[model samples]
Target: MRKHTGKSVSRRLVLKAAAVGGTALAMPAIVSRSVLASSGEINIMMWSDYLPDPFRDAFTKKTGIKINFTGIGSNDDILNKMKATNGQGFDLISPTLNRSLLWEPLGLIQPFDMKKIPIDKVNPAMAKMGETVWNFGGKGVAWVPHIWGTEGVSWRTDKFKPAGEFPSYGDIWDDANAGKTMGRGHSVMLGAGLALERKGEMAPGSMWAAYQSPEKMTEVWSKLTEYCIGKKKNLKLLWNDADTQKNGLLNEGVIVAQTWDGPPIALKTAGEPVMYRAPVEGAMAWVDGLALPVGVKNVDQVYAFIEACYDAALAGEAIKTHGYNSPVTGADKFAGDVYAKNFADAYPGDALAKLNPWPPEAPWYAEKRTEFVNKFMSA
Candidate 1:
């Protein structure tokens, strides 16, 4: 009944983890003057509404430190700026789970002191994310798990018809659905790779590692090439953000499209004909965690900031406000029934009942993304 509405945020795709240069480095200088140049002020880079007034107000009230926050475009942007500063200015950075693998090794990150964090306050699920994304094999020990969510089919019910068996990634290739479906760019390509996995064709250590083999890679590539290049004409829309995916379905650009849970959940609450459906085969899931950049001067301040957010009460509020799943396990007890019902709609009933959290596995992505891009995108 209560729908979430806010301005659409820019989606940043990190093509590569390149060092910042003249213009890139200068951008943060401008932000510093406008945001964190005051005494006892800390600048934070994160997604919009991720840290609401409650948390900031609570933190400031509790710690006597001013919170100066800036909404960044993407994880890559966050990393680029932190790298440029050599981890000098910004106190905290929130980046996607997989991408953290890249940042951790660059000396951009360092481990946080567990003594500062009340381990009991954190949700077990989030702790797992922290271990996998930021602390992958003790690589970048500085980051902590924040809010997390996934990519899947967020559809407009009035415009599109989903039948008996819920659609899977393989459905994207169906000719009958041509020009009536949309897909997310970059990240959803990982979903496309998963589709390849469903067909028993994919390589080891690829995005489809859950369903791949070294022997089947060649056959998988041949098949994937046909779908992406040969069937490119059938795609009604290729979107990069949640707004575009929702708009495409509403505007008739596509009937069913891959999306995160937020947009469709918003539309449904507004009494619009829309739904968020995660495929039966499994959806491409992503998790994001908060990390302290290496070389932070105010390590105690950073720890205090993380500790405040780690409080289950604040984390629950963030999960509700953002419409993303909380990696914090017990936070669910604080959520409304509508949030649970709506969130559950995205998954198949059976699978939803026993959801298996997606693991943060980077070596799999690093090794395989190139071949997939070359075979699917190029073709």
Candidate 2:
């Protein structure tokens, strides 16, 4: 064997190295305290609103470790960056459920040290999702549950009313609601497809799932595509994120569109007559979390960061700031009257109980993204 000495290598080599290195499982080497101190920050790759000012400020005030927040792009962008970096010089990443499966298998991320961040501290439902999803189909550890929420239909009570007491997923395809409705670009179709399948109908996971198949995923996709195309005349907009969907319903009067719980909760709190319903067939729920990458330099600091996030007060701040329910135990107590009042006044009875579990691990989504996107999402 020849000694290897190169400052840079090809990207393909980086990926191959990660796979060969078991996703950079073991740390390369610990840098000296002086070297780490000279670098002066804990780098983070996460979603927007993940680490709000209060959480960031509280952490910095407690420890002098500055946060160099980067990677605010799409999930693919962040995962590709982590893959390219080969587990070096980053502390944490909070990828969605789908991305975790890919990263963990390649050993791009490290197994979460439960002792450093006790798994019991998180919400039980979220904890279960994390255990199954991040734990690599029961063998590997990759992503952890950072945030979780459901995708469902949201409607403006101020503008319209359907014929029935409760709205169903099939309401989107109804002609009576025509031109007053919207589905979330392709996510609407995918989520609806999931809802349909959970209720014994078939549609692909994404509109693109039509091209790739176990046949089931494509069956779901095709149904959703037909539903959307048929209802295209009824749509006002195809939404992407929570805020846009909320504003579209509130300001634009797009009465019914697929959305998560956060916006409807916020709008209702602000005295808007908005409602997020968990259709009889159930809704699609998602869970995300924090994990140390393979190359993270400061294990101690990374552990501290995880613990800080799990802290009840910090977790409460994250909940208030981000609007997702916290995974941290006892965060409800720290939630204060604002959270309590809003939460209590927000949903209908059994709303929390009605929200269902999202499928834990799905490898095919990332492995087949191009096919899924092309068939379903593309206009």
Candidate 3:
């Protein structure tokens, strides 16, 4: 069994590399907790790997905060779980940075009490993302960075080669790779929109502009959905989480797929023939951050648990054992050198500049996009 490492590359290096890729990183959110953990109990709903068993156990022993944890797989899973309970069950919830905009309308989250958190230890850029993007009503913050990564292309090295100077999202739909590729449903649609935009089929910036309004989203997505439907034969299967991605490339005969950076990189580090990389159109970068559910019951305990999460050393140690990139400053020093190398290997020359940060979306647009995804999946 292989474990994913975290905070491996310094944020400065990553931000610089992204600069070289010809794009800027913004609107990202991902964070963790602190070492001055108060004693108590807290319920956590986050990605399964976010709290590796070792970290959870160590946190339990050190802080004496008996944690009741429920791990979720995707932002959709996070949304559904919160909605299913009306935000009453979990104390700490993790959702991707780009997805933060949807929570306010659902009335599911409360603004994070920054004074209760160790915000000073977090990565400056990630903290700014939360401060600006997660601020609801211009007064309170609703999310903080925990873990950040990207969604991009991966391939079976023995089976395929990029057609140009760099891999583009377009490669996923090319006839040659058809029947051998995969992607998450909604993101693949976004990738399609991007490819279409580049080909002059859709207006420039149409993909990001779809986030602004339902009318715009509908117009942009309509074309994207149709193009994706036409390319349906290209995918072997659409993966929803890390396991499916690994299995698709490792066992299900998939040669290429749009994937979170972690999965394929994990495989490659383990000596598999797979390779993951940023695409020419850009690697979709995002951060999964911690948020407070509105009805959080154990308020004090929640703060304690949150503070424990921000402890840079613990966060870095967790990364050494799981698949995540921390937003906690000083955590990278603990993730070992391999992660930095992996970062370099994946972004190879200007791939970082191509980072296509996932833009914020309206709750309505999110719902509408889900419908489009379902339509494409069923078509």
Candidate 2's TM-score: 0.73
lDDT of 3 by residue, 1-379 (tens): 1222332343565543322220121111332333334567788888766676777676676656788988776888989888998988888898887776677678888887788788898877778777877787786888887887788889999998887756778888888888888889888878877877788888989988888889988888888888899989988888887888899999999998888888887788677998888887777877888889988987877776666567777676666555457777777675657666666667777766567777776779878988998999999
Task: Give the worst 10-residue stretch by lDDT in candidate 2.
Answer: 19-28
- Give lDDT for model 1: 0.58
Q: Write the per-residue lDDT of candidate 1 for residues 268-316, one digit (tens) a residue.
A: 7556788877676565555567777666666566666665565555565
The per-residue C-alpha lDDT of model 2 at residue 238 equals: 69
lDDT order of candidates, best first?
3, 2, 1
Residue 37, model 2: lDDT of 39
Better of 1 and 2 by lDDT: 2
Over the stretch 1-379, how does candidate 2's per-residue lDDT look in tens digits?
1111110121122222222210111111332343233324688887654666667765665566788887452466577787787877678887766455566667777677675565676655456555665686565455556665556677888766645554666666567777777776545665556556655655323433443455756565556666555556776776655567677887776887777667676676567787766565555555567777878876677766666666666566566655556656666565545555555433335444444444333467545534654554454
Determine which window of 10 residues in candidate 1 has minimal summed lDDT.
14-23
- Candidate 1 backbone collisions, by pair: 110-142, 111-141, 111-142, 152-259, 157-273, 180-255, 278-346
Models, CA RMSD each: 9.5, 12.9, 6.4
Whole-model lDDT values for every prediction: 0.58, 0.59, 0.76
